[model samples]
Target chain A: MTTTERRLRTAFEDAARTIEPGSLAPLTIPSRRRRGTWTVPVAVAAALAMVLVGATLIGDRMRGGPPPAQALAAGGPQHILAVRAGRAVVEDVTGHRLFEVPRAEGRYRAVAGTAREFFLAVQTTEDTYSFYRVTLGADGAPSRPRKLPGPLFRTQTGFGKPENLAASPDGSKLAVVGTVDGHAQVDVIDVRTGAHRIWRTPEGGAITSATWSQDNRTLGFLWGPKAADLRLLDTRGDGAELEDARVLRGSSIRSRAPGFGLINVFVFNPDGRTLTAQVQGTKTGDHDDTGYVLLPLSASTGEPAGRPVRLPSDSFFVKTDTTGRHLLQIIDGRPGRVEDGRFSWISRAADYDDAAW
Target chain B: MTLFREHQLSLTRTALMIVGDRATAEDVVQDAFAETHRRIGRLTDHDRMLPYVRAAVVNRCRTVLRRRALALRVGRVHEPPVWSAESAAMLGEDRREVFLALRRLPRRQREALVLRYYLDVDDAEIAEVMGISRSTVRSTIARALAALGRQLGENA
Candidate 1:
């Protein structure tokens, strides 16, 4: 063998020795998965199920609850923080530029926060990110950007430099998905104390579309390569491992239906019981006619709970305002509003990559 | 099941070389064994079971690397078994450097080298596990050795 081959063999042996066989846990065989045999029962209950669903819809209408199609457009916030061409600006609901957050080092990449308070992150270096908070005055003028106190984050590489940043509905906590030593990590930071609780991934996978629930403690995110399903992480839990987050298998539209295709973007409705997602394909597998639709999925089971709202065009961004009724959607680079089950263009095409109300 | 029990540790160690961590490696192996057991009724040839499980483990490892998202939740912090500074300390600088260099290789090249050198499997077995021809296995291992040497600043 050559000297290089000898060196490699020795190195491999040394590395293998690090794991002792005695340390391995006993094999825990997985239990057999029982197949469902409920087809006959399901068929028998189909008519009754439809009647019950119709009654529930009528009850919801009588209670004056927002229609599922227009639930996210109920009362939208007026001011928004958006990142456009490396600049962070506060804008009105109509896409009119209101006030620009003062520029510092690095390019602004992400904007997430709610109400009068918002947070943005700047990619200071490749893989490094820093957070800043911008609070809007009553008149909608943005305050000077305040740098958040914390260690700079080593975010995953690529265009979305902030990885995924979501501030709690109350703006009291911030959850940032980043990387530490090449492994994915989620760090939840307390806005008041600047303290951090980190959850580390045991393996590698891209985590995106971070959305906070109404409780301000449950974090919902899309874990991907396939964008399979949305996963939930409890921020208040003491666990420091990402596995502490439960995989909501039902939250995945693709698994819910074979032809659903990929879920491009999703957010938790204010009630935290439904996920509003922009999903591709249709149940009939008619890919040519139907492109994409705004879908509301059960947060727990990923089943479609409401009729899909058709978009004017393909949309990659969707953000719900504090009321959970107001939705701001970006389609083909233009901002629009999804209200009363209809989409109306609200502004000319903008260069913004991300925005939040 | 007996074949899996006999080779579980070695297979996991092989998977660790591909996946860069022990938890995922073990998970990959366990899933592969469970799958093999699930399909045992379909297998009439007993001799092929070991090779089938090895290929399954390797394929599952590839899936884990591709999905790249670790969704498992634990109650405490999970210190990754490799690449971290603390793991580097445990692995020693020489082996750490080698592992790091191995990680930089393409997935196929890295797998080829691991199966050959780490598992000390012959070219035929490497081909069987990797689903490539014996000649391709030899060529891949050769290219991997040269590439690894270049990264390690050594003469191949």
Candidate 2:
């Protein structure tokens, strides 16, 4: 079977296991009079009303309040770096093309960085990814792609290429995460010097969505065999093992009470006290209710801290700017930004594989 | 009654993927069985009884969705079905992504996919269950696979 077919079968089997045979109620057939009668309709109507009222209460309580004003304004992030068909391109907030960052070889799989400074990962081989730095000039012209020397990142096939590059707030350190020999590895590179620090998951796991705290010493990332927990790693610590990283208290995707459903991507705000995450809301039957909220989680506890800003359906990525006022969001491969808690699509097509501001 | 007892769990689980919750799925399966039982005299071909009951379950799920839509239009909206905590625990993150992408598909596409993939039924059976031509089943499954792959960021 193909990957799609395999995934479909796996998903079906997993969902099926939720209803065990032993747990099922006894089967009883309704009589003829019970089916074609007014009494049945009346009973169903009453039951439906009660269920609806209960649902309304739950929805109201979980929806939370409107988002904060300053954090959502549209007028943030002067430029965005996006990867299209393995090449890097620059675009305005409205998604108008400015220019492409010319590369001689390799596909640009991931991107990160902020303001005029940006980093791109060019896949030089099947599993090897080389890093490069690009800086935007005052006139918005991108400087030539400059290769950064150090250990290359490894992105294996089964793990699905994640957001593996994160540039620190001061641009002094670059964190790269990927897998090698089935073990998760993170390499933090010092920009000024070619030296770097390395941390590895000794057993096995896949790491993705790495972000930097303002302190420049704390790196937060999603670690997985399950990849459900968001872990905070101290770069300044002596240990090179990933076990030393602290799993934020409530970061699991399975967090039910006071929790957000699936968080596909997240980034630290400028303050480093909170994280803005794209959360999938409670799903309805056969309805694509994904990407319902961009919620803020307390950095220490992993619990929700503030009101969640609603997002366009299927929005996955979230990039926060330095001021923590503006945000860049990608909905179903189309780039957009949130302003005043409202989402407006950039005029670009939905071809961007990855983008960052 | 024998057939319903034999296949109750499997059929109810199938309905769960279509309707999105356990309780409603069980109800859909039960209603299908009850309707089948009520009209057993008309089922002359024992060989095709399973497919017929499967079709009934699919049809009942469609009705449930239709009623929910109508309720929304008339300003009597119920809470959307959520995967229970147990269901969520059973599904992995990757499988959950697959389910979310599946939900985004059109109703017909979703139906065709569940019939072909989840049911593991052949094209002819899917056509019979969906009340479409065999050729339409093939095409619909093809289109559904491509659309689902695109949404999941993969090439079918």
Candidate 3:
């Protein structure tokens, strides 16, 4: 059966076998939500039902239990964002907003790069970098963000293009990814030490994104144009391809602007084989301008290691990053799909990239 | 209005997965359904109510978590779903691994992910539900994905 047909059957079967007229509450008069939701709502309601309960419960325990003593009290989580004031909003049917923050001062966009803990966001006026942390409550009131200890001491390779700040879970290290000199680069700063390093895309252009391995031993990201390649930086191991770069297997679609292409490396699956992103019509971060695409990574040689998967074309792709490689990724295991039976996309569209959630 | 009941058993499970406590997940789902009923009309689409409700429960839980952070002033978040590793295996492959990894993310990242992928909801919807602007949704998702990708690529 076609994927669509199977999904339809699954939806119908799920609906028939499990959906009680009463269980559903009256269906909302269809309105702006489809536009608001990507494609039709996810087809696997029955399966997700179990996940729904488990997720909420787990989330609750994490919330109520005494604070985890494991976390060091000295340094906290550091985050950066490409914050923009009210461009779009997340709300439910009656217009009661779920995300209840101030009509923000600005929106924060995440700059994804190797597992640099914090983004070295320095105002143009200063070359030094500091850490910023803002705590957001479910009620949406944000605690006044405070700067953490130490400061960055180098110019980033992203050149501040996708300027972003992030802190390691332990809050000991911070990485800042952004465009510098029109190129995307990531800078790593020792939260304990003033020491830092500037990682520039050797090929040129903005760095689309970057990530660090579980051990934080290797860092990888996308950079350059048609010849754009995946760059891996190893802090302690030899992780780079023999050629020093692994080119993504996909067409290079130019951005709406002539001579510009807006393809980014979305996420390197835990196995580090699959990538998800949108080849957009423009460079700016607007869903109006983009759709999701899957890019498969193979050995530096162009061998078909596995089939490249495409997200349901109707589905809109968001710009969020999952946590450490050892971190969990939401997956859909329908046989031959994203490996480990997991798909990493989560919640509606995540805000401000992943600097914060 | 009783959609939570339709899937209450499962919702109970989902909550447990997130909170790591069966009893608490049941309470959360029950409350979530009640909240969903209160917010029913406002939720807009019938199709998305399940995820909406799920997101709501998860959001509520995350709310509790933020307070925990403040109580400590600085520390950690992210505990595995309640399922034992073996029992967790009973879940669909995608849900188990990803959710496990997701919990590893900062609370905000985990919340952003649940709303983004689990519900297959859009950024605007997430922004509305999370009460943040769409731009922030975009930023969080981007960073979250990058974080996941990096962890997967280099470590795997």
Taking the tens digit of each residue's C-alpha lDDT, what string does model 2 give over A148-228? 877665655311134567889888888877656656778898877758888986555446668899898899876643334
**Runs with alpha carbons beyond 4 Å of true place in candidate 1:** A1-75, A158-163, A178-180, A224-227, A250-259, A282-290, B1-156
List DockQ for all candidates: 0.10, 0.17, 0.03
lDDT of 2 by residue, B113-138 (tens): 88877778998898899897664565
- Root mean square deviation (Cα) for candidate 3: 20.6
Better of 2 and 3 by lDDT: 2
By lDDT rank, best first, the candidates go 2, 1, 3
Give the least accurate 10-residue stretch of model 2 chain A, judged by summed lDDT: A65-74
Tens digits of per-residue lDDT for model 3 on A1-357? 212122222322232222233443322322333343533455467568879988988998989843321211222222222222322222221222444323322333322223322232333223443344444443434455444455433343312223234444344556555545434456666656656666554333334445444444444555433234555555443332223334544324432221233344444444445444433222112111223334333424322344334343212222233431221111111001122223333233332222222
Chain A of candidate 1 gets a TM-score of: 0.71
Off by over 4 Å in 2: A1-75, A157-162, A224-227, A252-260, A285-291, B1-156
Candidate with top lDDT is: 2
Candidate scoring better on lDDT of 1 and 2: 2
Per-residue lDDT tens digits for candidate 1, residues B1-156, read: 888999988988888888878889889988898888888899898987777888999998878765552322223333346655676678787777777767655576778888888788887788898897664565456545544543454433
